[model samples]
Target: MKQINTLLESNYQSHPAFNFGPNSWAVSTERLAAFNEVYAAAQQLSPTLDADSRASIRQDLEHALNDIFTAFEAQSTDVYEARFLFELKNACVRLMGEELAWYAGQPRSRFVNLTNKRTRQDTVRLQRDRHFFGRLPEAAAAELRNLAESALGPCRANAAVGRLRREDLSVNSGRTVHALRNVLNREFKSLGVLDAVSAYTGRKTRVTGLALELSVPQATWWKNAIAGLERPPRTLYAHVDETIACPKSIVYLSDVTEQNGPTSCYPGAYEAMQLNPLQEIIGRIVGTVGSQADSPLKEYYAKQYHQSVNSENFRRHFMRLPKCLRFNSHIGWDVLPGSELENELAASEIKMTGPAGTFIAFDGARLLHRGGLMQEGERVALQVIFSDSTFTERAVNKLKRML
Candidate 1:
């Protein structure tokens, strides 16, 4: 615990923008005023303004954003910090209230069984200490990055079908696609992802559901500040990839940088959840806590939703279910943000960032994680899921005799 605290404190300075528990980066009044200027300018950017004048304002806004960070290094601090801190505290207090209210509404029995004992400590131990990080040999990393980039051209072309915040790809060209597949498969084995899953489940495992995801720059927050001219961007809430019942997953960062957005996760939190009965309830609501029958793909990838080529128009390919049923199908944040549980989980958060070729192998079904918000540059990655070969048979044996 002392070591973790030390790391968090050192990182707080290195990552001024990062919200590291109560040790947030200090901001000064001068910096706050600069941000105010930018916000005011952004509000006034009208269609009536000449293109050159509008461009100038845009530059001013960019400069102001930089100034805000610069001021953080300066020693002076005052009411600007106090006011902002108050607002931050107030928001959390309100969220805590909401969490309490939610708990009150639940059945009393839900809280009665709470205990002091830890549950699944071993499972939690496996995920603690940032167990998901490693680097590939330079040559191997370079080859994979180049192959992933080759598919980007085709990926962008398909975006017109409708681009999502996360790009999914299907390079139709046989040669390029084949090469990409070969590299990914080779790396998957080299990285010991298959072996790890096999050990976890006590059966041989195979990789499936390989995907390439790309994130590009966009002013997604524009609609949030403006009225109804356009809708706010869709938020990609945190989730686990358990739909395919994969015991584990591996993500390869083909291209990355500090500004390109990194993946964020809550280490040890998955195991912490084992102690909470409410977690099981939340998982059921989010479609992760159920039995095999609850899963659409009994054998995994039973329908197009489970296995489909990536494209802008991919949603159109899924078999339509009733609107009500769709709610249960979404694998999104298991718990509501700003809730009590969310606050408890935040302390364990770790943002994974690296150059191209860094990969994270994890028990995806057990982890609570989310994609990072891209600030500048693009982020590209490949994801692969693995399941034990005997998973289907084991699940079948667990089911009651139909007769």
Candidate 2:
């Protein structure tokens, strides 16, 4: 009990972003008291209970915890409070054990409850952590690996940028390729991947694009490429693809290690970075000034107000700015190196690295992610984007009709 209270206090003190002004503090205090009273009662009743009494007490405790969870869920405007509640609930689950088993069984409405054990676990993880990982069947992975190696052989020889579009494959319409695509599509559909994506974006979604990528040592190439540019490629830094969400799945065709520059992202940032009106305004202004002509004025602005200009909060909000206003032709906004945001993101970073056949899915639009900074060895991967139908499929259909 003492440890729980200490943890609660420590968490509250450390996370300043959760502080939503005076009323929030009051609400937090009330919730804390309520949690303590209920938790203390459970602790007291744990020992010396007969089977019947234990069952009754367990039912009561479950209802109490669910009521608290429901209350926090209802306060959607106070995300910090919800985060706090999530933490406390985790603690309670750990301490109480089987008394709270029912809570663990209840999946969130946003995720499909698949019957397959592996897919079910992955779906639950994706719902909770905004990412999930698995592997393709070994035979399929081997075939894909061979195809990738063959396709990139020329680019590797010249040390050129390594990317192979789906259309560029020599056997793009061959049986092997079709079989592999069918396997992937079937696996993802069985896992309810599209349904999960639609739940996140609040619209229907489908697989929109696919490509093969290779990452090799490019230190000299990158230096020469960025020599006269205002900024390096945005992909070199952590960023989101758009204000609207687009999730991605990547299948590693080669072993990826830290030196191989596997994709990395800040977990939970997808949900945490949601902005209010004031944050959006500040972010847009800072982003606009930073993207202006690379002159003394731009340098001056960066130097004079770099703290706010490069802050993680402002930068995240800036990345969320509407596409029209931002005029960002690239995939996403870059978080400057050594910025406050980078430091925070680094603390929680999850690198997507594993043996060949490893597959991972994550939200690209909302999560701050970056990759392709390889230092040694080569990495071959298949990247696929699954996005809202409104963004890709419908437009394609409209074009077909016009043609």
Candidate 3:
């Protein structure tokens, strides 16, 4: 990992359009090498792929590295910028989803988990308990399955449909996913994590804040991904960190495109909780996004909007996001020495991203997050989470299971 200070503070300049600071980002070199290998392999495997498929794949990988190079300039200098490692994270997510799916005999599209506790469907269904785990039947599964079957080349068709049909596994007691995993490996002549994806990969790092997992396995991640957005009736919600009797956890999952909008993240802004007060002081360090037009709608005008920039009040209701999306950072603001606010809530109406397979683990206690919407096209992920991972006491993570 290259240090941010050396490259950023040294020889760099900020282009007005992309707002990242002089030294606010960095990415793991290992991640870069992995993508290179995957890119080459993809081209070799599908040299004859259609224009749309080739274009989508090229755009996706191009952004994966381009965003990393851009963010690395700042990540080298700031510890805070380190928290928003979407570049490295999304690289890993894409590899895990696509590469791993191939290793497990499932097609990229067939290997998804949108039923986690984070979906709009779950909030509509999970009344008593918010533990988002296992399988469920719905229109999404049926619709996605049809898409997957049609997407298969002549040789891969039957294999893809078999994987999609497994949604019939019930979610009741002793749901014995192990048996299903074995069957998938046999049918596909592949590895067995069709069950592992449904397993929880992490748990809350702290005890006092929100008690939830960091990265859940498989289909679960997809479920959590979807639940992070806002739609219908509810524009935004207050943090029930305290005073709530039974507050539910949120997560997201992905399909290829806009039909399901995975939460959009404010690039390099994941550590917004480390921010200082809204006084004139912050304007000295970094800037804000959108209408500097000076109305009450300015980015961090909490008093005016009753929330921070991370709040849905500022969410730029997005639809039809390009497959290769890019972000501009806000400048003239400062992240302080210590957390100063009273209600250090997670960001709301914010966005997050991942490719096909990997997961981004977040400290929900330190984030103001939301999944946002399930638009009308293919989405890029699946989101699911373990119970609430926020810590009111705020989980003091000594170490997470996977690091």
Best by lDDT: 2
Q: Candidate 3 lDDT, tens digit per residue, 86-107?
A: 3333433443344322322212
Candidate 1 Cα misplacement greater than 4 A, ranges: 1-131, 158-162, 165-178, 219-236, 275-342, 389-403
Q: Per-residue alpha-carbon lDDT of model 2 for 132-237, expressed as tens digits?
A: 7777677777877775666566546545543332233223334444454555676667657666655554456556556666667753322212122355433354
**Candidate 1 residue-wise lDDT, 67-170, digit = tens:** 54344334224433333223323332333233323222212222111131221232233335324565667787778668667678766655545554343434
How do the predictions measure up, each by TM-score? 0.46, 0.49, 0.21
- How much is the lDDT of residue 370 in candidate 3? 40
Clashing pairs in model 2? none
Q: State the C-alpha lDDT per candidate.
A: 0.44, 0.51, 0.29
Instruction: For candidate 1, give the lDDT of residue 36.
Output: 51
Clashes of 2: 0
Ranking by TM-score: 2, 1, 3
lDDT of 1 at 82: 33
For candidate 3, the C-alpha RMSD (Å) to the true structure equals 21.7
Top model by TM-score, which number?
Answer: 2
Question: Number of backbone collisions per candidate, in order?
Answer: 0, 0, 93
